[model samples]
Target: MIAVPRAQLRRPLLSSVLHILSVLFVFDLVFAVTSRSLFSACASLALVGLVAAVSNAKYESLREPFVFTDLSLFSQLFSHPRLYLPFLSVGKVVAIGAGIVLVIAGFIVERPVLPGSRALVWLAAVLPFALAFPVAARLPLTLDPYVDQCRNGFFAVFVAYLLNGLRPATFRRFREVVAAGPFATGKPIRCPDVILIQSESFFDARRLGDEVAPELFRRFDDARREAVWHGEITVPAWGANTMRTEFAVLTGTESFSLGYARFYPYAFVRNKIASLASWFGRCGYDTVAIHPYYADFFGRDRVFPLLGFARFLDIRHFASASRAGPYVADASVAEAIVAELEAADDDRPRFVFAMTMENHGPLHLEQVLPGESSSRHTLGEHASWRDLTAYLRHIENADAMIGRLLDHLRTSDRETVVCFYGDHVPALPHVFEKLGVNPQHSDYFIWRNYGADAPERRNLAAEELGAALLRVVQDHGNRAEQPHASEKAT
Candidate 1:
C-alpha cells in the first residue's frame, strides 16, 4: 500500500503535482548518494509514513495536527523518547524501528548507482536542490497548519510552512507584538514576596467520577476558599506544551497574537518583551525561576534571563531533592521555593516562579500504587483506571505542595502572595475518552497572606492570569496605605 493515504491525497492538481515532485526530489537525492533505486524508494516512502504517523499521533493526543513548529522539537524528541514514545502504540514503534534498520542496511549493502564518478554523483545530488528552488518559490502557502496539511500533502505542507517561517515578515510581526509595554506598571507601597507555582497536569480528578475522592484536592479546595481570586483559566495548550500557557501567563500576551510563535514562544521570539518577572524586577523585587527539569528542554536557560529573571534554579538545584516517581517530587520543589525566599539576607521582595514536574505524564509507564486502583481513586476496574490512579497519586503530592506553600506564605511576617495554577491538563486521552470528558480548562487561583479583599471568583484566559494577579497585588498595596478606622478617628 502507498504510504500516502487516499484521504490525504484528495487535493487540487497543483498540490498533487507539488507533493509528487517533493517525494521524487527526496528519492533522487538519496538514490544519487547511495546508488540504490530500491532503497531510495523505500526511504522516501518511509519518510511519508513517519510524517503521517506523527501528525496522527499528535492530533489524537493533543487535538492538533503536526505543523512546522513541531519540527523544532525533532532533535529533542530523539533525546527525550520517554516523553513522546509512549503516545505511539507498540506496533507503530516497531514499524518505525524496522524502517530505520532498513534504511541503515540499504546504505551499507547497496552498491553506488554512479560508482567511480564522484563528480557526477555530486552533480546528481545538487540537481534536486536546484530544481526544488523554483518549485518552492511559486508554491501556494497557508498559515493555518491543519487546513494546509489536509488540503496539500504532508511533505508539501511541511515544506510550505518551513519556507513561510523563514520569511522576514514573520519575524517583523513577532517583534511588533512583543514591543508592547510591560505586563504591569507602578510600584507597590510595599513589595511582597510572590510565589507562583505552575503545577504539572493538575486538575480536579473528582471530575472523572464519584470514585475520585474529593479529599484528593482538599488542600487545593482550602486554598480556593481563602483565595483573593479563583477560577477555571483557559490555557493555550491541552495535554502538553506547558510553555505556551507559561508564556501567556508570564508575558500577558495571548497565544493567538503570537502567530506561528505561539507553538514554541521560548525558542522563536528572540527579543524579550514585558513579562510578569520583568515587571516585578522593576518594582525592586528579586526575580527567580525554578523548574525541576532540564533547563534547556525549551531553551529556558537562555530565555529566562531575557525574561528578567535574575537567577534560574533548574534540575541542578534540585539534585538533592527526593523523587516521587520518575521526576523530582513537587514537595521538594515547594521546599526549594521556601528556601529561596528565606535565604535572602536583604529585605528585597522576591518573585519566584516554579514549574513542577512530578506529575508530568506518560503516567501509564509507572505502576499504580498497590491501592491506587481502589474505589477511592477509580470508580471501577476500567481500562483507564491505572492511568487515572497514577495521576491521582502524583496529584496528591501536588496538593500537598500547595498546602505546604500556603502554610509558609500564611505565616510569613512580611506580606506575601501565592499563585497556583496548572500548566495544562494531563495526557490522559484514554481516561477522558472513557469518561466522556472534554478536557479543556485548567484551574487557577491567586491568594494573599494578609488582605481584607473579599474572595472573587472569575474565569480568565491564561494570558490574563498575570494581569489579574498583578491587580490583586496592587489592590493589596493600595489598601495597605489607607488610614484605618481607629487611625482616622484619632
Candidate 2:
C-alpha cells in the first residue's frame, strides 16, 4: 500500500483553522473601534466566527476547490493598505488620526470598552463573508469573485453607516414610501347602517389543529350565516399598527396604496378622508366610532373627525371597566356600544364602529385571563402551541362578548347589523419557524371557517371589505321581506 502524505492529512484541518481565523480577524478589526481590548475582542469574534463557520460547514461541504481573482483578493486585503506606509500616506494619516481621537476619548471617559460590546460591530463588518460562505458552499463556486465584491461593498458600507449614524433623510424617505394615502377609489356605495368591529389579533389560528377554542369556532360558524363573513383578509402590519388597519377598513383603501396615508393619523392630518362614516352621514345615517382604549393612543380624536363621525366614544365614555390583558375588556366595549346605540336619535338609523383591545401583546396565559386558575402548562407557555392556545382563550372571551351583543340586538326594536373581523395575526415572532407555516402563505388562511352558505371562497383586503359588508346588509333586508314574498306567491 502507498503511504499517505502527512501534509494531506493536515491540509483540511489547516484550511478550516485559517478560515475561522480570517473571519475572527475581520470581526476584530471592525469591533476594535468600540472594544479597545484586542484579546477579548479577538476571542469573542473567534467564538462567533467558529459557530457560524462550523454550522455552515456542517450543512454544506467545504472540500470543493474554488478559483478567485488575485486583483479582488488584493483589494480586499488592502482595503486601506496605506496604513502600513512610512509617511505622507493619506490612508495611514487618517487611521493615525482616528486612533489618536479614540485614545483621547478613552482617557477622558475612564471606562474600557468590553469584549462583547463591539462584537456586533465587528460581526457587521464581516457579515458578507459569513453569509456568503454557506451559500457558496451549498451552490456552485462560479462567480465567487463578483459575489464577494458586491457583498463586501454593499454590506461594509452599511455597517460603517450603522456604526456611525444613519441620516434622518433615510427615515423620511421610508416614511414617504410607506406613508401613502387614500388607497381606495374613495367613492361611497350607498348602504344601510354600518357596524364595524376591529377585533384584536383576530387571526384564525385553528388551522393548526381542531382542538383550539372549539366553542369559538362554533360561534364563527353561526356568525357566518348571520353576516357576510369574508375569510383570508390580509392585515398590513403584524403586531401593532392597529390604526392603519382601522384607517384602511373605514376609508375603503389600502393604507400603502396612496403615496401618503400609510403613516396612520399623520396621513389623516395631511389629507381629507371620506370614510364609511362620512359616506353614511351623506345618506342620513347617524355615525359613531368607539374604542375601549385611551382616545389619544393613535390620535383617534383628530382622525375620527376626518372620517366624518359625529361622535367618538372611548374608554372615558364607558360606565363600567372590564380588563382583558392591558386594555379595556371586549365585554365592556360591547356593553358601551349598546349604550351608544340606545342614546342615538331613534329617527335616523345608526352606524357604529367599535374596536376591542383586550387581546393585545405578550400573550402570557396569565396576562390574558388574569385570575383564571387553569394550569399554565395547559396554555403551552414556552412553545408556539401554548402561545396559540392562550391567544384562542382571549378570542373565546371576545366571542362571548359578541354573543352578548347579538342577544342585545335581537331584543332591540331597531334592525341592527354587525360586521367584525380580526385586525391581524398574533405576536408570535417564532410562529413561522415553530409552526412551519410559510409567511407568504398568509392569503391561505380564511377568516370565515368552512361552513354552510358562506361565499364560495375568497381572499379579503381592506378595499374589498366595505362592499362585502354592504352585501350583508342587503341580504339581511331581503331576508326580512322573504316571508311577505312567499305569502304573495300563495
lDDT of 2 by residue, 1-490 (tens): 0111111222233234434444555555544554545544444544443333322321121111111111122332244332112212355346445655654554455545665445566665566445534432332212222232232321221222222122344345434533343322333332334567888877666664544445565555556545445456776555555665776677666654532234343332433456677767766788888887666656677667866789888878764686865567888888888887787776777888888888875554343344232432233444445555566667788778777776666556555667777776665655545556533212211121111243435678855576566555545333453332123334
Those runs of model 1 whose alpha carbons end farther than 4 Å from true positions after fitting are 1-9, 115-147, 181-186, 481-490
**Residue-level error in angstroms, candidate 2, position 421:** 1.2
RMSD of each: 3.8, 15.5
Q: Against the true structure, what is each candidate's TM-score? A: 0.89, 0.57
Top TM-score prediction, candidate number? 1
Error of 2 at 255 (Å): 3.5
lDDT per model vs. reference: 0.79, 0.52
> After superposition on all CA atoms, how large is the RMSD of candidate 2?
15.5
What's model 1's lDDT at 180? 67
Q: Relative to the unseen true structure, what is the C-alpha lDDT of residue 383 in candidate 1, on a scale of 0 to 100?
A: 53
Relative to the true structure, candidate 1 reaches a TM of 0.89
- Stretches of candidate 2 exceeding 4 Å from the true structure: 1-192, 260-265, 365-386, 438-457, 474-480, 483-490
